[model samples]
Target: MSPRWKWKGAEAKALAEPISKTVSILQSSLTRTEASGLLSNHNVLLSVEAEQAELLDRSCFGRPVVACAEKEDKRWIQLTFEEAFFLFYNLNCIKISLHGRRLENEVELWRFVRSIKPNFATSYKAYSHLRLKNWIVRPGLQYGVDFVVYRHHPSLVHSEFAVLVKSVDGNDRLRVWSDSHCSVRLTGSVAKTLLVLYINGEEVNREDMNLPLCLEDYTVEEVTVRRWSPELNREHDLSL
Candidate 1:
């Protein structure tokens, strides 16, 4: 299937919610309460449709579900807050509802996501870029990075890259030596490349934040870190 699809009015209503998003169980029949019960553990989305369930099957966005209703037909997939925000603002695939009402534009969506996570704009920029590249991007908290990128779906293979997103803003401090050292060890242990992605752009002007934020306007420099073991470097050293 193509990675993108349009949502019908009814479909939007069934999946999007106001305070937070809620997805109804559509693939199978289930009450709203049952769907809500399925999302209680994951603080991502408020609910999900049981039929198109993905989160339970795999850790799509890096957020894992701890406890969910057991019935197969009763299962649903809820996008975490970050996932919902990313879908609406970055991908332009889904619209979100607010308190029984649908949002009018991207600005409103940006406001909502920012209100929930103060650093969402920065995080979203990095997220949007990787996602647009079509990589399987998931949370990287476990790897001491911003995201774990899979060339193939997570279920099929281990992640190939662990990404750390950094901004151009001087206010953000440089990563300490210890942090970098630790990240290299952690990612290496898991057989993943550590990519430090430095994003260059102006600080977001929330009031003037435009819809369809042009990611091209910004730039990224990806630095890959690898531990230099003397044993592994012997061949190169001999050549030198």
Candidate 2:
């Protein structure tokens, strides 16, 4: 059997297969999530046999890594913080360890993740939201977006939309006209629509908010940002 992760409308063969095993991600371990806010399925190290390496290379489940080909080398699959938390909170498939200590529960894990990721709440909401829709959300830093959502596994099809999480509260100082101008053009060039996901809700106290499951309390709205070029939309004088 493969990893145990599943979701609504998920296909068995190509989805993120969560394994029933303890995945120890050391604090020192390098993962794709750090450098890029996006994730890939190449981090979580597993306890598979040498022969299984050949099989893992073909599936989206895992990828075999051989740094130096030492006899003591262990195989692993990598997961971003969002992916790791999803498995733990939603599916309860794998246990997480940071620097040799196991994160006992979601609360503990949340606290730990918060210490590292400042935008954990907003990004996670967007991540989980897309996930429930059966869209595969992957890293989109390359496209200058928070995420690139795929209709299916990334390898099977192109991502239809690029998402950027923003807040509806205040003037949203992070966004400006120039940013929108650049983002729309960048996404358009790649054939992906830019979606500005606006999150709104009551502001929660950080001291206590991070302690509870408050993702449901927030509301998410998606606005598609498209380029308007009059040259392409010109109305011809057919009557003349």
What is the per-residue lDDT of model 2 for residues 19-136, given as tens digits with 9 covering 90 to 100?
A: 2211222211222122111122223344433433333333223344556353553444555667666655764555666555666678877777767776777878888787666566
TM-score of every candidate relative to the true structure: 0.66, 0.69
Query: Looking at candidate 1, what is the lDDT of residue 111?
Result: 60
Q: How close is candidate 2 to the true structure, as a TM-score?
A: 0.69
Q: List model 1 lDDT by residue over 1-240, tens digit each.
A: 111212335334323421121121221222322333111223344344444355333325424244865565444345655566655555344545665566777676666655666656667777777766656678888777778886544544567888887875533423687877888888888788888788776665655444436454668777888888878776575756
Over 4 Å off, model 1? 1-49, 54-75, 170-174, 203-206, 209-216, 237-240
Regions more than 4 Å wrong, model 2 = 1-74, 168-174, 231-240
CA lDDT of each candidate?
A: 0.57, 0.61
Clashing pairs in model 1? 17-97, 18-97, 18-98, 18-99, 44-80, 44-81
Mind sharing the TM-score for model 1? Answer: 0.66
